[model samples]
Every structure is written in C-alpha cells, then in structure tokens.
Target chain A: MKILLCTDGSSYTARALDLGVRVARKAASAVDILVVAKRDREEKARQMAEKAAADLETAGIPVAIHRRSGQMTEEVVLQAQAASYDLVIIGGRERRGVMRLLLGSPALRVTEHVPASVLVVKGQARDLKQVLVCSSGGPTSERTVRFAGRLARALGASVILLHVMSQLPLTKSAVLDDLEASAEELIRRGSPEGVHLGRMLDLLATEGRTGHAVIRRGLVRDEILAESREGQYDLIVIGAHITPGLNARLVEDLSAAILLTANRPVLVVR
Target chain B: MRRRQGKRLNWRKPGLALSGFLLFTLALGLMKGGAGGLTPLLRNHLEVTNAADSMGFGWLMAYLVLSGSPVAAAAVALLSASVLSYLQAFTMIAGSRLGACLVVLLIGCIYILRGHEHWTALTAGILSLLLTGSIQLAALPMGLLILGRGWLDGLSIPALEGLAAGINWGLEPLIGPLAAFLPGWALFVAGVGLVTLSFRLFDRALPQMRLERTDLGQIPRLVYRPEVMFLMGLAITLLTMSVSISVGILVPLSARGYMRRENIIPYILGANISTLADTLIAAALLGDPRAVTVVVTHIVCAAIISLLLILLAYRPYERAISNALAWIARRRNNFALFLGVIFVIPVVLILL
Candidate 1:
C-alpha cells in the first residue's frame, strides 16, 4: 500500500508524521510526505517534508518527500488525486470562529474532498490495535470492510464490525418479530443484516483474520462513537458518503461527522 | 364491460379528497363566524391575553385533540375575528406544533406495549419531539423579531381573494341558517369537530402506508444530510398536510430499520414548517392578509433556523440531542421527569 502523509510544520502535523511512520512500518507500505507552505515559506515546507521523510526512512520504510507552496488543503488534495496512494494521513486541528462554524479546518476539508481513504489523526496518537469497522450494510461498506480487514491484518489487530440498527417500522401492526432478534439470532435466521455481517466476517477471514460482529440499535453516528469508546478502539473505520447525484448533499456524511467529533484517529474509506 | 371497468377503477381516494376539501371549507366558515365568541372565554376563563398564554392555550388544545393543524387553524380564525393579535396567533401556531409531536409519542407507546424494546420503540418519537421542540423554540425569538420589523406584514396573495369569495358564495346559504339557529360558541365547537373530521378524510385520501421492506431497498441504509432530510420532511408534510401523519410514517420506517435518529432530526424540522399548510389555507379562506403573514413568519423563521442549525452547528446540536436521549434512556425516572416537564411547562406558560 502507498500512503501519503501531509504536514505543515506544526506540532500537530509532527504527531501525524510520527503516526504515519509507525503505520507504514507495520504495514510494509511505502510513504510519501507532502508539506505545503505559504508563498514565502518554501524553506520551512521543505524542511518539514524532509524531516517527515527521514523519520520514515529510519524506520526502514521506503520514503519520498515533496514540498509545495500553495493552499494547504488544495495542495494535499492535488497530490492525493495525482498519486495512487491507498491512504492519506493528516493531523486534525481544533478550528474556531467562522471556520469552525461554517467551513471546518483545512484538515477536515481535505478529508472530505480527498479521493483516497483518509486517516485523520486526532487526540493521543497510538498504535493500531483494536479496530472498529462501522458498516451501514450499503454496497459501499463492502469496500470499507475489506479495506479495514486488510489494515487490521497488517497491524495484527483485533477487529470488531459494528452495525447500528436504528430504523423501526412506521406502525405497530407491521410484524417486528425479526427486528427484535439479536445479531446472533439474525445470523441464524439469515436476515439481511445478519447475512451482511456474515459476509463481512468471511471477507475478514479471507484476509487471514477473524472479526466479531456486534449490533447496536440507536442513532448511527452515536452508536459508532459509543462502541468505539466502550471498546477503546485505536482506530475507527467508516465508509465515505456515497450519495450520488445532485441530491448527494442531502445525505449526511457519517465519516465526516466521525472525523469532526471522534477524539481518536478515524479511517474513512471511499 | 364499461360498467365493470368503471367499477374496477378506484374512486375512493378522489371521493374522499373532495369530501375533505368541502369539509375544510365548511369548517373555516363556521370557525370564522363563531371566533368572536371565543374572545371572552379566551380572556376571562383561559386568560390567554398574552402571546405566551395564547401559545399555551394552543398547546393544550392540540393535546385535547391529539393534533396541531386544527389548533393552528383555530389561531387563524381567532386572528381574523380580532380575538387574537398576529403575534399571539404566530406563537399559538408554534405551540400547536410542539403539542403535535405527541401523536408520534403515542404511536411509540403502542410499539412499546406490543413488546418492542423501550429505546427502539420510542427513539423516533422522542427525537421527533426533541427536534421540533428545540428548533421551534429557538426560532420563536427570531419569529417575534420578524413580526416586530413588519417584514412580512404587507405580504398578500390577491388570488386568494377570489378563492375566498367563491367559498363564501358556496357556503353562504348553509352558514346563514346555522348562524341564526346556533350560538357563537356552539358554532365554534362544531367547527372544531368538522376540521378534525376533514383531516381524517384527507388522511384517508392519502396513499396507504403499507410500504413493504423490499420497497425501500433502493433507499441506502445511511445517515442522510440534514438538509436533504429537511426537504423530504417538508415535501411529505406538504403532500399529507399533517405533521402527525408524516412523523407517524417515520415510526414504521424506523421500526423497519430503515431510519436513524440522525436522519429524523432534519426530517422533523422540515415537517414542522410545512405542517402548517392547512393553517395557511385557513388564513387565505378568512381573507385576512395579516393572518397569512403570521403563518408565513413562522415558516420563514423556522426554515432559517433549521438551515443554520444544519449548516453551522450540526455536530454540537446532534451531540446535545444524543446526550439528552441517553439521559432519558439511562433511567426510568429520567424519562418520567422529561414527560412531566413537557406537560408542566405549557401549564406554566398559561398561568404566566
């Protein structure tokens, strides 16, 4: 896997660089560090990129560094789109004022716009261990599950697939015997959610890893965050919003919400 | 063969729709004629002299009928009769919406009685009430500001005058005899019943809520953007002309595992704004331009507040709602406290 690590010479980006190096070393992935600076800050940008690259090289990971002078988010997005990197890692910053209220921080914008999967490093940096893969059971989640399985296999981490059952039939008269069933029971009955869970587990098994499926019924994002908190997972993996067409903005992007709110690192797969 | 074909093509929906329209028109006429009688009761007995009191009155009235649109229509009739001021009418309509969410709660209670998990059965209703209560209440100050500035005061629809005149032409003969025989208060009581009946007929005319799980297969099982859900809520309510019906469908959708708490918030927000379609029609029927403006104020304020919440502070707002849900679900006492507070606040408003 090829990984792109983004930096801006900040302490936050330094933490992301360190986390990126560890991840690349564990997964045996090649790394490229891209640092974007303001028009006159090219020297600082080059220094940050080289430092991040040297850290990766010292870990015995194949590393390359690139420096660009432009808008940080635009530059990072351009590089990610240009390359065939499987993942783009960046550090999240606490935004304030109009930026926090209207547009999110540059890191968040890049995460939302980038084509590759984004791993937004926030809060305390930690090694990949317990992984929480949030599955909406949509077709796109198959890719998220497979990608998470591969990442887990590389990191030798335990995997937990969480499916939140938040929908209820509109009327009481409709038979809800199946809805009341547990995840285990649903799997036994071959219910759609159950079958989806079974298929995801099988995919993980193909990656030479075993994963447990857990079901929670509540708000989708809340349940995912709650499960991540309860399990103390090192990384939370979710699928990018796949609301195609003009009405795409009408759909909530759960991955973006997770990135904005989750205290730990979040890996959003496209 | 022609007769058989005629019998085969269903006319029940169209027939019910015509009946509902006639009933709605009749209800509007009755309420307008009798609204003056409500003034004394409203001022002396209910003591709904202030905007807050009128809002409380509307809220309690919705609780009495288990719906809000009728209460909102009542506000318009009262406004037309000079019984309630424009601001009072606006707040009353807002309060009716707060009370309207109870219908969803009642549906959730039925689910619980039928042996569904407490949170699973109640989440849609709880979130519906929460979203409606929060967004409407937050919009109240802004609505008041808009009214104060007289922003929509001059807003008028000249086309409605012809419609109102046509309605008068059709209903004058029926109302004249009733006006002579019935007391004003009695006419108002009868009007309320007719309005409720009209709503029932309209609901019957609506497409049946018999959606199969397979029918929703194309709808992705993901959290929709608040704006998308908001528009959906608006569109559905506009079609059904009842927030209760729109939110009621959400319960079944949620029960079927096709909706989430996050998806329903904006949906409920949009539903609340458009649920006033009946009230808006009532305003037009009364030929009171200001009545139309009052309802328009609520709609405009609500749309602005909902959009701002979705765009700017959605994460924090969502977190707050989720935390409130957790608190309610954490203990039986918490739920009881919530229910008690919702009931008590309206009474307090009336007393104030």
Candidate 2:
C-alpha cells in the first residue's frame, strides 16, 4: 500500500508525519510526504518535506519528498488524485473562536472536499493505542470500517466500533400505505442499524484486528462526543458522508459534528 | 336474453355513507342541545362561575363523555341556553380540550396490558396529553385576557349566516318527527350513538395506512424535523377530524420503533389546534355571536401558546418532557404513578 501525507510546516503537520511513518513501517507501505506552500514559502515547505522523508527513511521505510506551491487543500487534493495512494493523512489546523468561524482550517476543508478518504490528525499521541469509529449503517459504513481495520492492523491498535440510535425514535406518516405497496420481498426491508455494525466487525476480523462493539442510544452527536471524551481514545474515525436521501437530512450529520468537536484526531473516511 | 344490471355511482358504498354521516351529525347536534336535561344539575354542582372552575368542569364533562367534541357542544349549548355565562362557556371549551388528551392515554393502557412496554405503548398518548396541556395551559391566561377585553368579539359572523340557516332548515323536518316519537333523554342517547356512527364513517372513508411490521418497525426509530412533524400532525388531524384517531395512528408506529421523542410534541400541538374544528361547527350551529366569540377565544389562545412554544422554548420543553418520559420508562413503579396521576387529576377536579 502507498500513502500520501500532507504538511504545511505546522505542529499538526509534524503529527501527521509521525502517524504516516509509524503506519508505513508496520504495513510495509511506501510514504510520499508532500509540503504544500505559497510561492514565497516554497523553501520552508521543501525543508519540512525533506525532514519528514528523512524521518521515514531512518525507520527503514521507503519514502519520497514532494513540494508544491498553491492553495494547501487544493494542492494536497490534486497530489493524492495524481498518485495511486491508498490513504491521505493530513494535520488539523487549530484556531480559536471567530477565526475558526470565518476562516475554516485547511484540514477541515480537505476532508470536506476530498473524494477519497482523508485523516485529519488532531492530537500528539504517538503510540497509536486506541481508536473509536462511529457508524450509522449507511452505504459508506463498510468503507469506513474497512479503512479503520487497516489502520488498526498497521498500528497494532485496538478498535471500538460504535453505532448510535435515538433513545426516542420519531415516526412520520408514509405518503403511500406500504401495505398497498407491491414489490418483491427485497424491497420490503428497511435499513436496520445492526446490519452496519455486523459488517464492520466482520471486515475488521478479516484484517485480523479484534475490537469490541458499542451500541449507544441517545442523540448521535452527543453520544459520540461523550464516548470519545470518556474513553480518551487516540483516534476517532467516522464516515464523511451518509447515503444521501431525504431521510438522511432529518438528523444533523454526525460526522461533521464529531470532526469539529472531538478532542482526539478524527479520520473522516469516505 | 341477457339480464342487464344497472349501476349509478353505487351510493350505498361511498355516497349513501357520506350522506348518512351528514345526517348523523345533524341529529347529534339536535341531541346535544336537548340531552342536557342533566346540564342544570351539573352547572349548579360544579359552581363554574369563572375560567378556572369552567375549565375544571369542562374537563370533567369531557372525561365523562370520553370525547372532546361532545363536551364542547355541551359548552356551547349551555352558553346559548343561558345555562353558562360567556366566560364559563369559553373556559369550559379549554377544559374539554385538556380532558380529550386522556383518550389516547387510555388506549395506550390497553396496549400496555397486552404486553407492550409502557414506554412504546404510552409515549404517543402521553405526548398528546403533554403538548395539549402545555399549549392549552399557556393559552388559558391569553384566552381570558382576550375574552375580557372583547378584542376578537367584534369579529363578524356574516359568512356563517347562510350556513346556520341551511343547517337549521334541513334538520327541522327530521327534528319534529324524532322529537314526537322519542323522549328528551332518548334524544340525547340517540344523538351520542349517531355521533359515534359519524366518526366511524369518517374513519372508514380514510385510506388505510396498513403499514407492515417492517415499515412499522422502521418508523419508530426515524425522526423528523419539528416543523415537518407539526405540519404533518395538523394535516392528519384535519383529515381524520379527531385527535384520538391521529394519536392512535402513532401507537402502532411507536410500538414498531417508528416514533422519535421530538417529533411527537409538535405533531400533537398541531393536532390539538386542528381538533377544535368540531367546536367551530358547534359554535356556528348555536348562532349566538357570543358562542362564536367563545370558540375563537379557545382557538386563538391555543394558537398563541403553541406558536410561542414552538418558536421559543421548544428545546427546553422537549427536553423536560423527554427526560420525564425516560424516567418513567426506565421504571415500572413510575409508570404506575404516572397512570394514577393522570386518572385522578380529573376525578379530583370534578369533586372540587
């Protein structure tokens, strides 16, 4: 497997480099460290890339240094697309209060716009001890579970797969009486949440990564945030998007909320 | 030779039923006014001089009948017949609404007995009570103030003039023969039966929801936006013309895991306000401008209170109700306490 790691010469960027090195060394994957900078800061960007590459090389892992100039998110996105990389790891830029509201951090933007999976490394935890993954059993859940498993296998980490259900479910009258609805048996079933957790556990087992499953009933965002804080897990993984439908829009997107509020690193896998 | 079978709209199925429903409603209205031979006893014993007492009296009356519309009709009849003052009549309507909320909860009790958990079985019914209680309670003071000021009283009933005349003219022929054949008390009993039949007809005309277990199971877990639920509640109540029916629809949905905690309150609020349409008809039938004023006060008060809560304090209100519900659902003893409280409140009010 090949991985693309993006840095902007920031503290979070350094953490991303650490994660990439550790992951690549365990999985025997090649790492390409890319430093995205403006025209004036190209020299600074290249130096950061060279340092990341040297660090990976010392671990006896294959590595390359790439330097680019332009918008940080756009350059990283372009480079990942241009190369055949299995995963893209980036660092979250922390800003306070109004600055965050007006100017979104680069890492959030990359996760929002990227078609491929992007991990926004948040904390400085290096041992890769624990990971928490949240799922709603949407279409993207299988991919999210599979990717989290791969990460666990590479880092020798334990996984916690969580699925949050509403304590009080809401009912809406259907437009057509489903009783009058005519179709095969396949069309009759609903998207049960347990189906997602089961698939995730099965996928993780295939990768030889063992994990415990948590079924929480409450507000999705609140339960996820509370669990992450209480567990103090090293990393949090969630789907970047749900299977888009009118039903999907009813609740606030759990992924977006967790990524913003989670103190630990959040990997918004697509 | 082939025999030809003739058909014309098959009035027996839909049309005859519709006409019978209308006739039943007409009969029920006449029966409502005449049936109150017991009205004098109730008024004197209840001592309902003001809004508070009237609300208490109306609530008890609705509980006795197990229906809001009949109590609302009784309120209007009392107002028209000089049995209750305008203030007493208006407050009685409010009380009837509060009492009407218990009907769904009573149905929920049946579900609970049949082996469903108290949480799923009673959530819809309890939500109906809570939303109705909150909005109606909020509107009580506003309704009193509005009626006291005579601000809305000046609104004309010109549009209803034609409707009032047509209803009386059509029902007058049927009333004479029925009155001569039936005693006064019999008229009220027959009216209650006909009213029940009319509601049954309405229920029959509605397209079947007929949700399978799969759909029923899914809806309980799904949640909708407050505004969406509010509109849905209003629309369904308008179609069914009864809050009990709308709430009963939620029971199966809740049991199957289709209801959300947040979706129910707003929907109940919508259904509560819309359910007053029956009283509106009752007010028109009375043909007293003051009767119209009383009903309007009920509507305006409920609307103001519900709108305010939906816009401003919905989250806190939702949380408070939900937390309480969760507390009850988590324990068997608490559920019994809740049932006792709901059952006894009206009984205590009736006695006092």
Candidate 3:
C-alpha cells in the first residue's frame, strides 16, 4: 500500500506525521511526504519535506519526499486522483471566518470527490489505544468498519461501535394509546431496532472483529463527541460520507463539525 | 447515490418498457370495452343489496388475485357501464384496497413460519393494509356524497381524456378483433392479466433498489420526518404502478435489516394514493367523463385522509400502528388469532 501525508507544518501536523509513520511501518506501506507552498516558499517547503522523509526513513520505513508550489487543495486532489494511493493523510487546522471561507478546509471537499480513503488527524495521539467507529447505519460505514478492524487487529486494541438516533417526530419515550380502550390493551412494546443491530453485529463478526455497540437517542454529533471524550479513545473512525441528494449538505456539515470538535485523532475512511 | 450502471439494458432509452406501457394501456382499454359487454352477467352475480355487501364482493375480488388495482379498476368500469351504483363501486374499491394489503401480511406469515423475527417481517405489511383500509374506508362516505352532488365534473383533465381517446382509437385494430372473437368474461380476464403483466414489465424497467446504498446497513432507522417518507412512497409507487411492489421492495431491504416499522405507514400512504393511476386508466378507457371523475374522487379522498393524517396526527398514528403490530407479532397465538380474525371479517362481510 502507498500512503501520502499532506501537512502544513503545525504541532497537529507533527502528530499526523507520527501517526502516518507508525501506520506505514506497521502495514509495510510506502510513504510520501508532500509539502505545497507558493513559489516564494517552494524551497523552504522542500527542506521541510526532506527533513520529515529523513526521520521516517531512519525509523526503517521507505519514504519519498516532494514539494510543489501551487494551491494546496488542487495539488492534493490532482495527486490523489492521478495515482492509486491507498490512503491520504492530512492534518486539520482550526480556521477563523475569512480563512475558513476562502481556504475552506480541503479535507471536507477531498472526501466528497476523491475515491481514496482519507485520515484526518485532529489531535496528538502517539499510539492507538481504544478506537471508536461512528456509524449512521449507512453503506459508506463499511469501509470505516473494515479499516477500524484492521487497525484494531494490528494494534491489539478494542473497537466500540457508536450509533446515535435522532428524535424529531416525538419524544423518544412518547407512545400513543387509545384513550377509550380498557387497561387490558396497554402492553409494553419497544422499537424493533434490535433486529437491525443484530445485522450490524453480524457485519463485525464476518470481518473476524469483535465489537461492542452503544446506542444514544440524541443529536448525532453531540452524542459521538460525548462518547469519544468519555471513552478517551485514541482515534475515531468515521466514514467520509458524501451523502446523496438533500442529505448531502447536512451529513457533510456534520462530518466537518465532528472533525473540528473532536479532541482525538479522526480517521475519515471513504 | 451514484447510480451503479447496469451491464445490458440502457435504462436511459427504456424503449421496450415504453412499448410495454402502451400495450398495458391498450389492454386496460380493452378490458374496459370488454367489461361493457359483461355488465349484465357481472351485475347478476356481483350485485349486492347494500353497501356492506358490495364491499365484501370487492374484498373477495381482490383476495382472488392478491391485487387491489384491477379490482378497483373493475369497480370503476362497472360504475361507468351503469352496472353498479357509485356507492357500491366506492365501497367495493375500499374493500379491494383492504384485500390488496393482504399480500404483504401473507408474505410475512411465510417469514414467521421460516423463523424470522415477527416484528421485522410483518410490521410493514400489516401497517400497509391498515393505513390504506382506514383512509379509504373513511373516505367512502364523503366520496359517495360528492358523487351524488357531481362536484367533480369540472375537475377532469382534458389531457388525460385526450390520451385515453388517442389510445382507444389507435388500438381499435388490435382490440376490435379480440372483442369480436372472445367472450366478454374472457376479455375482462385477459385485460386484467395484461394489466398485471404491464405492471410486472414496468417493475423490470425501474432502477434497481441497491440495498447497499439504502443506509439500513448500519441501523434499521425510521425516517422521523413523515412528509419525506410520504413523498418517497408516492414517487416510488408512481414509478412502479403497483402498491405491492412499492411495499414489497421494503421486505427484501428489511430482511437485510434496516427499515423501521414507523417508516412503513407513510410509504404505504403514498403508495396507496398513486396506486390509483392504473385504475384511472381503467376509468378513462370507459369514456364516461364521470368514470374519470370517479377515479379522481378516489385520488382526492385518499389524498385528503392521508394528508390529514400527516398534518394532524402522524406521530400518534405511527406509534399506534407500530404498537398494535408489535402486540400482534409478540406471540404465536396472537399472530394466529389475528390472521384468523382478519380473514374471517371479510368473509363475514360478504356473507352478511
């Protein structure tokens, strides 16, 4: 497998670099460190790439370093599309009003168009400990599940599946019964989500990965963040959902929101 | 969702399916024409002294074939031919809808017997029948009153009338021979068969429901928004032209384990509304402008009740339906008894 690491040279970028090195060494993947800068800083960018590459190679991992002077998003998209790189790793930065709008993070857009798996490291995690695979019960989560499984197997870590249900119709506890019916009619019934969860559990079993699932009936992002922080997970694995139709904007926004709010490393598998 | 392209047929042109639709329309038109000759014989056998009796006949008719559209179409055709009163036809169509929903529940019965979870398999089918039956039954009284007042005469679609006209005239070469040679009942049967065949072909022509993209892979989540699922159901039914196919698609998807019981009702509500399109074709073929009026009446009545449910009490409605189905599916005895009761009531309605 070949992996590309795109960085803007920040502390978070260093953390991403470390994670990338560890993954490449463990999985025997070839690594490329790419630094994109405007023409004036092109030479500086080359020095940064070569230095990062030297450190990775000294750790006994194969490495290639390249520096390009162009737009960051365009360069990575072109490179990722032009080649069948197994995974692309990028570090996310906290952006304010104008920077966020004009430069509007490339990771969000890249996940939308690119077919390759992406891992966006949000925080500094030296090693993989506990992993959280966020699921919306959609098909795109298949890649996330498998990727998490491989990492867990490789690192001997545990996996947790987190599902959040949104209560928009009525209060989650509310039920409608006939006002006129006798007491004999009132028997307790629960939602049939168990059958669906059974299937999801089967998906994990088929992958030869054992996992425990936690369900929360609340806002999707809030619940996921709460689980990640409470679990003190080292990494969060979620699908880079390019949601279809009207669901696209909402899902993409949620993905971005989760990426920004998460205090731990986030791996967005496509 | 990226529409996964198929290997063979360009769903783009759909030339063959379009031809199948034309023939299907022609078949329905022929059925209308043939039904005209069988009016006396049908009136002799299917005639009922009261509305309840006619409804029972409708139930029996739909039960015979496990489809509601043809039976509803037949009722409208009989109305156009003056073989049955508007009240009789309205009640009968309601009964046919009630009976049509049986197909899903019946399929669920097989699932239960095969050891699948009752809540997963039967909920969709039961909710489909219950929703359609309640709305249509509720719509019947107002429908009869509206028919008596003749309020819908101005509401006819000139374009639809013309389309029906063009079809009948164009297909005379084919229909005339069959009409001349075949007995009336046979032609009616043949028309029903062709209508079913047309629907089957149309289903073949639809974009396959890729279960992988359905998102049920992660959770059997219900669409909390009733309006969205309602429109989705309407759109899917319009495309398939069969309520069973619209609802049946959920079965295989649910078997893969992701559809919620709450999602079933509104989808059935939408499907039940558009499932009347084929009946409208049957009514149009009769050439009585009033027959088209009757078809519209069916559409309006259903749409009104459905929209009313969606706007006013959709949540409670979904909860009640879900709770009731769960109660019924909770035990083998309850399942058997409910099955016996549903079957016995329609038979008793006919006997009464």
Candidate 4:
C-alpha cells in the first residue's frame, strides 16, 4: 500500500504526518508527503518540502516529498491523478468569518474534487481502536466494510457496521429479522464463498453485524455521526461521492461531517 | 502597459461608433416620420385593406421574423431606416416604441454608474453597447443568410396570416364598440405603457433574485453525467409540445383577455419589432444595410418563438434560465449561452 501524506506545516498537519508514518510503517507501505503551495513562493515551498522529507526520514519511514504550486486544489488533484497513491492524508482546521466566506479552505476544495480516498486527521486524537463503517446496500458500502474490517483486524480492534434505514414504521420483530438476514447475507456474499463465515461474522450475528446494528432514522450524515459518538468508535469510515487532493479542504465534502463534528479520524473511500 | 493602452483605444473607437449609430438611427426615424407626414400616411395605411397586396404584410412579417432576435432585428431596422427610408419610416414608428426599452436598459446602466466619474461611466456605457452590438451585427447576417430568403418568405407569410386570422377572430366582436369609443392611438399607447411598466417592475425585482452557480469544473465528480443532457432535452421537448398543444386548444378562451387574437399578430409582430433594437443599433453604427436586412428577416420567424419557449420550458427547476443554460453548455461549448440568450431573452421580454 502507498499512502500520500499531505501537510501544510500546521500542528494538525504534523500530527497527521506522524499518524501517516506510523500507519505506513505498520502496513509496510512507502509514504509520499505532498506539500502544496501558492505559485509565487517556490523557494519557501521547496525548503518546507525538504524539511518535511527529512523529518519523515528520521522516523525510519521511507519518504518522497513532492512540492506543487498553483491553486492548491488543482495542484493536489493533478498530482493525485498522476500518482497511484492508495490513500491521501490531510489535516483539518476550523475556519471562520471572511476565510470561510471566500474560497473555502484548500482541504475542502480537494475533498470535493479529488478521486482518491481521503483520511482527515483532526487534532491530537490519534489512537484508533473502535472503527465505524456506514453501510448502504450498494457496492461502495461493501468495499467500505471490507476495508474497515481489514484495518480493525490489524489494530486488534472491534468493528461496527452501521446501516441507517430512514424508511420506517419500525415493528421491532420484522426489522430485526430483516436486518439479521441481510447482515448474514452481506457477510456470506461479501467475502469468498469458501472462506469461513465465522471470521467475518460479528459476535452478535443473530442480532446483526458486529459492534451494533444501529437503525436511527434521520439524515445520512447526522445518523452516522450520532452512531459514531453513541457507539464510541474512534475512527469512522464513510463512502465518499468525491475524492481528495493535496490542498483539498474538509468543508467541501458532505462526508467531512465526520471529521468536523466527530473529533475523530475520518477515512473516506470513493 | 502598451497592450492595455491598445485595448483601451480599440474599445474607445467602438464606443464612439456605437453612439454615432444610435443617434443616426434615431435621427433617421424622426426624419422619415417627418418627411412622410406621419398622421396621414399612418392613418391611410391602417384603413387600407392590404389583403390583395400580400407583399406589404409579407414584408412586415419578413421583417418581424428577421428581427425576432436582438442582433438581427436591430440591424434590419437600421438598414431599412437608412436605405429603404420610405418603408422604414413607418416601421421605425412601431420599432422605436419597442426598441425604446433597450434604450431604457442602456440608460439604467448609466444611472447605475452615476456615482462614478461621468466620463468613465459614459465610456463604459458606450464600450458595452459597442462590444455587444458588434457581436449582434456579426451574428445577424450569418443567421439570415444561412436560413435564406425563400424559407423566411414562406414563414413570414404564413405567420402573418395566422396572426391576422387569430386577431380577427378575437377582435371582430369588440371592434365596433372600440372604434366608436376609443381612438387607435389610445389603444396603442395603453399597450405600450403596459409593456413598459411590466419591464420596469421586472428590472427592479430581478437583482434581488439569487441563482446558484454549480461548479462542474471537475468532470469526474459531476452528479449528472453527460448522458443527462440528452434525457433532459427529451423531457423538455415533450413538455413544451404538450403545453403548446394545450395553449392552442385554449386560444378561443384566451381571446376574452385584453390581448385578443388580433393582438397575437401584433404581439408576434411586436416581438419582431422589439428584437430589431440590437441589430438596428449595430447597423446604424456600421452603416450596413444588406447585413441588417438579412439579419432582421431571419430573427422575425415564428420558429424563434417556438425555439425560445422550448428552451425556457427545459431550463432546470433549480436554475434560472441563465444558469441552466450554463450547465447545459458545460461540456459542449460556451457559445451555446450566447445563442440561447439571443433566442430566449427577446421572447421572454415580448411575451411578458
């Protein structure tokens, strides 16, 4: 796995870089740090990239730093498109007033336009144990679940697969029975036929998927975040309708609700 | 700096040319009306049954269709006023009334810039008209020549006859009472006033209306893919056809309104007359009659209205007529918006 770590020299970015290096070290993947800057200052941008590369190298994580200049969103998107980076990591900052009013922060624009998966590290909340994955009946949800399961397995953590069904006259018996059957089928069909269903199945399989089968009926973003907090998940994995670029800001993506409100790491898969 | 100065100079020349053109067109119109003894000729012409002289109505209809679009219509009117000064003299009376709205728009722009330097505001106003007018002039002749005289001849004759028939059906009952009580000019003035008032109200309100500019700069993230345009186009076509058919059925009922069937002829004729404002303004500046005639005939067609209605109906629900056009042109071409504006705005303005 090749991970792309995006930083802006902010403290939050530094934390994201540290987390990215750790993840890369564990996954045995090479780490590429992309520093996107405005076009007018090339020397400062290059110096920043060199310093970041040196810092990452000291951590024993193989690092390649790329310095890009232009409108941050376009530069990041262009690089992401050219490189076969499996994941993109970026830092999020709380925006307000005129900064928020004009062009939304670069991270938001990148999230809106990029095609690659994004991981937005918020602040100091680094240790990810309990993982939450919002599942729809679609293929994106299935891919998200499988990805979350792999990460959870690596961390020796528990996985929560949340399916928020907004439609209801929720008779508990019928709803529970339907959920059980769908969860069993998802596990059975989502994995290989010959592979043991026992490994994929949750401890509460008779009830539904592992962790919790949350059926809170509301907006998709609100329900996902509510479940994340209530269920005490450290990391939330959501399917994105868009990809993230180097300078892509968080506010642009609706899915960035997880990063903005949840105070947890958001792993967005496209 | 040098390039900027050159551009400024280039801009200034067009501005001067445009002001001169507008003044010339207005002067020519006044002169034609004066030369012909406006009251006698207008009254005589109104009373005469030109049913046998199909050419006169045909010419009117031809001019109407050609002037349906702003660029073409204005040029044609200007050309007619300059070369066929005799015919244009009468045409300008009606054309000027309709074209006066654009003059108002230009004037409004001036007022908007009132706080700025006088010379700068004047320069900007002239520059805007010149740039816009040049584009209209260039586009008009091409549109007319492509459509050709034969096709226009057929369209105008039928459209004029249809309009006349529609009006006669509507006005036959009221004509006697109206003739006895109201003068012709009274009705004309009332109609013109209503149009002008509606336009004023609309202009005042439109600025407050908000429209979203959906950024489709990234192709991969587009919610509605390229295939959606075809689907949307088909849906719009079906809806427009249905509405048109329904309107046709209700024409008799609609005749009861103040805008009787005969009004349809003038309504359509007024659209032709109004559309000529832009082109006429352009031609007056260029002093080109052939180009103006060609443009005017093409724009005045019934097809222009049909096309405009079709486009307006298809404009997306969330979008204004302008934004929907921008979205539709996202992948195809930028010129689509300009073409759409030429077709859509005049019809909307005239019908409203």
Candidate 4 per-residue C-alpha lDDT over A1-270 given as tens digits, one digit per residue, 9 for 90 to 100: 677876555556667776776566555357787886544455555665576667667767688888765554577677888887777777746575577657565565666567777777764556777777776434355556666665566566677666643221111111222222344453555422112233334322432335544444333455677787787777888777533352132112346545556667788876
lDDT of 2 by residue, B233-287 (tens): 7777876778877755665654433444556667778888888776676677557
Instruction: State the TM-score of the second chain for every model.
Output: 0.92, 0.83, 0.86, 0.32
- In terms of lDDT, the poorest run of 10 residues in model 2 chain A is A177-186
Task: Judge candidate 2 at residue A2 and give its lDDT.
Answer: 77
The lowest-lDDT stretch of 10 consecutive residues in candidate 1 chain A is A168-177
User: How accurate locally, in lDDT, is each candidate?
Assistant: 0.81, 0.69, 0.69, 0.43
- lDDT string, candidate 1, A191-269, tens digits: 8889999999998898888988999876787888899899999999998876667546556667777877798999989
Docking class of 4: incorrect
Summarize candidate 4's per-residue lDDT along B1-352 as a digit string, tens digits. 9999988877665565444433333332223222223234333553312211221322232234322122123324323333233233223323332322233224433453554222211221222222223323343444434444334232223443354345444544654454446554443333223323332332232211111122222211112221232222223223222111211222222111111111121122223223334343333333333444443453453234324433443222112322332243333243344334533543442332
Residue B112, candidate 1: alpha-carbon lDDT: 78
**Which digits, one per residue and each the tens of the lDDT, describe model 2 over residues A147-233?**
889888878899998876553322322211222222221123332444555567778999889887776554556678888888888
Q: Is candidate 2 or candidate 4 better by DockQ?
A: 2
Candidate 1 stretches with Cα past 4 Å from truth are: A1-14, A29-120, A173-191, A216-218, B1-15, B38-47, B113-119, B144-151, B207-220, B248-258
Pairs in clash, predicted candidate 3 = A137-B218, A137-B219, B220-B258
Give model 2's docking category: incorrect
B41: Cα error in model 2, Å? 2.9
After superposing candidate 3, which stretches have Cα over 4 Å from the reference?
Answer: A1-270, B1-8, B11-13, B113-120, B209-219, B248-255
- Order the numbered candidates by lDDT, best leading: 1, 2, 3, 4
- Which tens-of-lDDT digit does each residue in B1-73 have in candidate 1? 9988776545878899889988988998899899888778899998999999988888889888998988899
